[model samples]
Target: MLLETHVLQDTDPDLPALLADGFEVVGESWGAEFVIDGGAESTASLERLRGFVETARAAGLEIRELDARDAAAIESLDAESWVDVPTTPATVHVPVSALDVRDWATRGRRAFGALDGDRLVGLCVGAAGDNDFVVVAPDQRGRGIGGAVVAAWMLGAIEAGERSFSAGGALQNARSLAMIRAVGFRVTERWLSLQRP
Candidate 1:
């Protein structure tokens, strides 16, 4: 069962002893969202996102909008990014095949990527301006490329009159979680996949 974590927490009227008797949590995913709610991001938030893009530039990565053509180059990198994730049901990822990448690369008004010369080292994209995911190459993760890619995407998305953004990551993936939250995504859902022995 995919149960909201809060449903089993102290905030819930039902105690864990009453609700968790037979279910063992096998994995979890944090769902976050940042919506304009008929408005726009505050000025400070815009500055922070812009700063991430600049920081990525200082690290020698070129951040720019992506198109359908760049998909093949980064398909392998996208697949590789899922390697460290646990195979449990909740965290299972469908690697973005080259075709899948091509399909969504040009969607959502525009998507963005961080490139090291001719190589795509990180990408942030989704259909219709939703925050599907971001993946940075293993060697490039700590330098904020992932965050920059997403920030750049958000900048474009906001300018395009898009308002709603949503993203999710494994609860255990601190780096992924922090990157999204740093851009103002708030955790709205915490889903725990449970199994019966």
Candidate 2:
């Protein structure tokens, strides 16, 4: 298994060293955050990670993962409803173009949407994993949409033989934190970063 962590802009410079030390870069996301995965059982590797995290914190950074679900409704919601909302500066928005829904549908990952009298009010995007659903959506704040979508997503994940789910959010987003907690997710770990120019 790979130990995953999120790194910020100031921490980007340290990524090469971490990679050289055996960490694999999994994904580079928006907001200058990068996800790195590594083996957790090696003591020398772990110590190197400790130093990296401590340094990242000293420069003001954090890392974490979310409770993820794999469900049909998640994908449905995303396709049917999530497209209506405009991405704001305060929110983590994934443009619809970023996803290839036709491909996802064929892979057994279901998409879901929230309807308000035929108008799509919200959407949830999710993919099926071995043990969880990787879900993302725009209807997470004050509405009950987040919980509903997640419940639906979890149902799919469970049926698919996934034991659990995971998701992620930036510490700076209070709304996201509240929504994630409301759906029975707790912080599994903290990640720090050091963004550099």
Which candidate wins on lDDT?
1
- Per-model TM-score, in order, reads 0.83, 0.48
lDDT of 2: 0.42
Local distance difference test, each candidate: 0.76, 0.42
Which segments of model 1 are wrong by more than 4 Å? 1-21, 37-41, 105-110
Find the number of clashing residue pairs for candidate 2.
31
- By TM-score, how accurate is candidate 1? 0.83
lDDT of 1 by residue, 25-82 (tens): 7667777887766434566677888999999999888999977788786687788777
Candidate 1: residue 96 Cα off by (Å): 1.4
Per-residue lDDT tens digits for candidate 2, residues 1-197, read 53455464424567677666665543332221111233343334334334433443343332121122323333455454434433222234453332445456666655444334433333434566322122334543355544444444544454566544566545555554555565545555444432221
